[model samples]
Target: MNNKAFEVLQKEAPEVSEVWQQFLLKASALDEKTQNLVYLSVLSAFHLENRIPFHVKMAKMHGATRDEVISAVLVGLPALGNIVTTALSVAIEAFDKD
Candidate 1:
């Protein structure tokens, strides 16, 4: 349900989780926003609805615009089908938060 999964994973496997975090933070060729967008696409494709808003907010913090996230969600179109149309609303609302 949210980042609770990631939190639990880190706590349960701190060493491995730290390594994976370092890999994403340092080993990735993509920028932060790009990585977040990629994560969004993958999560949406997998129908991981619970994680959507969390990643959407992270992407926005990493400099992804609303339009950019819209495009990312659409990239999962073949697998997501009509869900993309509605998921966009959640993503947009994440960015709209006060």
Candidate 2:
């Protein structure tokens, strides 16, 4: 929520941000938990550490268990290798948070 780039985009190009939000809303065909799981996997694969916590929390809110969050992070290991480990701790910490 404190992402500066996103904040700047919303401030400077509100229309573009609105469109992106619309796209996300329309494009999310999967159930909320599944979508969050897919998103967590992508974030892990890409090593997007900064974004992981938010999505992990979202995933948990959508009924993802801590073990499911861990599995989601590790799901990319076969394809991408140990690089995904960088996100494992962050995701777990976020999911464990109350």
Model 2 alpha-carbon miss at residue 68, Å: 1.0
Q: CA RMSD for every model?
A: 2.7, 2.7
Q: Tell me the number of clashing residue pairs for each predicted model.
A: 0, 0
Q: Which ten-residue region of model 2 has the weakest summed lDDT?
A: 1-10
Model 2 over residues 1-98: C-alpha lDDT tens digits?
44688889999999999999778867888887888888889988987889988888888888999999999999999989999999999998898787
Q: Using lDDT as the measure, which candidate wins?
A: 2
Clashing residue pairs in candidate 2 (N, C-alpha, C atoms within 3 angstroms):
none
What's the lDDT for candidate 1? 0.81
Task: Estimate, for each residue in 69-93, the C-alpha lDDT of model 1 and write its tens digit.
Answer: 9889888788658866666777777
TM-score of each: 0.75, 0.81
TM-score of 1: 0.75
